[model samples]
Target: MKAIVLAACLVCMSNGAEYVVVVSKKSSFGALSVSQIRDVFLQKRRSLGEQKTIPVNVLGHDEVRAAFESRVLGMDRNRLNAYWVKQHFQGVTPPLTQPSFESVKAFVENVEGAIGYLPGSMVDAKVKAVYEF
Candidate 1:
């Protein structure tokens, strides 16, 4: 049992697949706690660290996006689809879904009140990691 647990942890750690959620280095939000992050993602909180929040999503299907959904939002693709489907017509959509991390970063950097995540290697000094999952 211990070995299995260790293996699972190792699997999660290998490459440390996830870094932290980041925004442009110019952002005022340097870091965030999990609950604070959850609030922003869920649209429950209007701001973080003196800046309004805009949470963006990765489009349709991407492996890293999948990780963000499951690992971060605690929701599966099906649930996510259902969620968007429900939000689509309400004139509300789940963030502006982007095709890649680059786009997300661009959006965040260009716009205030924006937040998104990319892989660790993709993150540079331009963006500051707000939270590490």
Candidate 2:
């Protein structure tokens, strides 16, 4: 299952499917470091300064989600599962999930502190992209 998902992500990347991390256009935050972005997604750090940061995840076994996990979070399935389990034990939780890139974009646009990742081509003026990979 992991191999299949990786293959799909590779195919998308080979076809010029660029992915980026995006935030609300109104957000005061600027470009974030990879570690900072990682912390946000992993729920290690909640707020970006004064604003309460809300991390959004791509739903299900999505290729984009897989890429984000591998390339951004640097976690594989087993590690991710264990991480989540530990978080659950600690009474913490993972980020919210969005069904699609469009939904993520819309959610980020409307919510001041929301942040998410999606295909770069789908980004519009409604949100500002902070990182790309």
Candidate 3:
């Protein structure tokens, strides 16, 4: 049983998708550090300099969302959920969520101050990648 579990873990790790943090191509902001991205997503920091920052998440337990949480936020689902719950009491909600990467890309592209992560292969001319993981 332990061996089977380890093998499953290895398979999941091997299949982990590459992701890139992106902003609108028209955004004046350049690349951001992981800390900056984290702060924006957590609602700890609202803007990059004078530009308002809007962070978007892939909704539900999708693999891309899991990867973003692990790589950018450095927190697993349970811990992140707990953090959101705590923040909710303070009137702080999690970032907006989209049902798909394509929608996320569109939202970031069309909405000023928007930011989101997409599978590396999905990035295109409409959005500029700020960070990758």
Who wins the TM-score comparison? 3
Order of the predicted models by TM-score, top scorer first: 3, 2, 1
TM-score for each model: 0.76, 0.85, 0.86
Lowest lDDT sum, 10 consecutive residues, model 1, at 11-20
Off by over 4 Å in 3: 1-17
Worst 10 residues of 2 by lDDT: 9-18
Which residue runs does candidate 1 get wrong by more than 4 Å?
1-17, 87-92
List the candidate 2 regions with Cα displacement exceeding 4 Å.
1-17
Better of 2 and 3 by TM-score: 3
List model 3 lDDT by residue over 6-48, tens digit each: 9998887656547899999999989899999999999999999
Worst 10 residues of 3 by lDDT: 10-19
User: What TM-score, to 2 decimals, does candidate 3 have?
Assistant: 0.86
lDDT of 1 by residue, 72-120 (tens): 7788989977876876777655666688878988887788778887877
Model 2 lDDT, full chain set:
0.89
